[model samples]
Target: MEPCSSPPLLSLGTATTSLSPHPKPIPTPTNTRLAAYYWFLVPGDVFNDYASLADEINEWWWFYDGVLINTSPMGGTLIARGYINGNIPHTGFPLVNLYAHFTY
Candidate 1:
């Protein structure tokens, strides 16, 4: 992932840090935590499967080189398809920012 600090996404009309994904509330945490804060969501666990994560998302953003190039309910499906087909342009580091929205 890139640094937590990033250029403003004024289009959203909100102030946020990349620390939280999309600045939306989640219905439940992978585990119960006070307010289900950002850090409470589970990180890399060998048990997490692709289908579960994919189905859990309400929306997401696809960033290339730290810039959001596509989004959910828009280009989200295409982005996921591209990734599955080995078409996403990931350079150097394979991990991109997680900018997803889960139901709240």
Candidate 2:
């Protein structure tokens, strides 16, 4: 399936502004971003029927800006890449990735 086929299930947004005398907050779109993805859990027996059999198995996805851009490979490693507001320098607002092992 294509990454853009689905929307994100969870989203979070943050903002930054200058607090000064006669301060007029600068609304920066560069500080904003979006992401989404889909997830499913199939039975271990069904997965084993396809190919190899393991004690644990699972599948999931990660989305960036309403598009699926990252994935969790079987074996417990996750990787994702995407772009954030390039206009904002040194801001790590666009990076997303995580890894964890399944416990039976």
Q: Write the per-residue lDDT of candidate 2 for residues 22-93, one digit (tens) a residue.
A: 877778787443343211122211111121111112222222222222234455444322223233232454
TM-scores for candidates 1 onward, in order: 0.16, 0.19
lDDT (0-100) at residue 104 of candidate 2?
38
**1-104: candidate 1 lDDT, tens digit per residue:** 77778777666655575555568875775764322111111243222223323232322322233334323444232233212212223223323223333333
CA RMSD for every model? 23.9, 24.6
Off by over 4 Å in 1: 1-30, 33-63, 69-71, 75-77, 81-104
lDDT of each: 0.32, 0.32
Clashes, model 2: 2
Backbone clashes in candidate 1 total: 1
